[model samples]
Target: MTQVLGIVDIVWRGRNIPVEKGAKFRLGGIKNTAVTYGRKVGRAQEFQGSEVMATTELEAGQRWGNTWDPGEGELQVVCDTGQTFVMYDAFLEGDIPEITGGEGGKIELKWAASAPEEIGV
Candidate 1:
């Protein structure tokens, strides 16, 4: 079955955190830093790709529970089209809920590379 990338379900640990239809997620993006290189005329900077990670923003109603904490676990990002990516030793960041008026809060999740060796130069 073909999985749709536009819509996906975020499974933390084992439970599914319901998300809004327009929920945004950045899956497996390039993480990199710039380095100065010596050039004949001048110095140039370049962006080198680093470890891959995932970032997501979820609506208030989609929040998992009352507490927002980073636990040692795996985050399963499954797309409706059937594609799935398992983030190993995953942890959450920017999980604070922002309240605006009577609307549900919005929480952001940043899944970083767990292993230090993978990110080592």
Candidate 2:
């Protein structure tokens, strides 16, 4: 079966974090930014995925992403075929959780990256 850019394994700042199976991740053009809409790829009959990403937790030394902070870090979306869509200097947009809901309290996270690099599996 040919992979069609579904099922993403996220690698934020080199840390691997896999999202829900129904999660839908998309990357924009060079001028545009990358965004991951939680919690599903498209609207069919699926619930949104929780645990979209890691957020604020100082004591845990876990504050390198989400929060829309600029750490010049990398946000990688590893595809099912092992193809990785890496974004350098990626930072979450201030107003995340754009959806704030989608019938089941689902949300959307927007991210901005300088340039995106796609690697083959």
> Using TM-score as the measure, which candidate wins?
1
lDDT of each: 0.52, 0.53
Q: What C-alpha RMSD separates each model from the true structure?
A: 7.2, 12.6
lDDT of 1 by residue, 2-94 (tens): 434677676777877655565444544435444555753443444332122233344545544532566656666676666666766766654
| Residue 62 shift from truth in candidate 1, angstroms | 9.8
Tens-place lDDT per residue, model 2, 14-114, is 76653455654555452323455886453333232212243222223434244334455788877786777778767766553433233433334445664
Model 1 stretches with alpha carbons more than 4 Å out: 1-4, 27-67, 114-121
Instruction: Tell me how candidate 2 scores on lDDT.
Output: 0.53
Model 1, global lDDT: 0.52
Flag clash pairs in model 1: 2-81, 3-81, 3-82, 4-81
Cα displacement (Å) at residue 77, model 2: 0.9
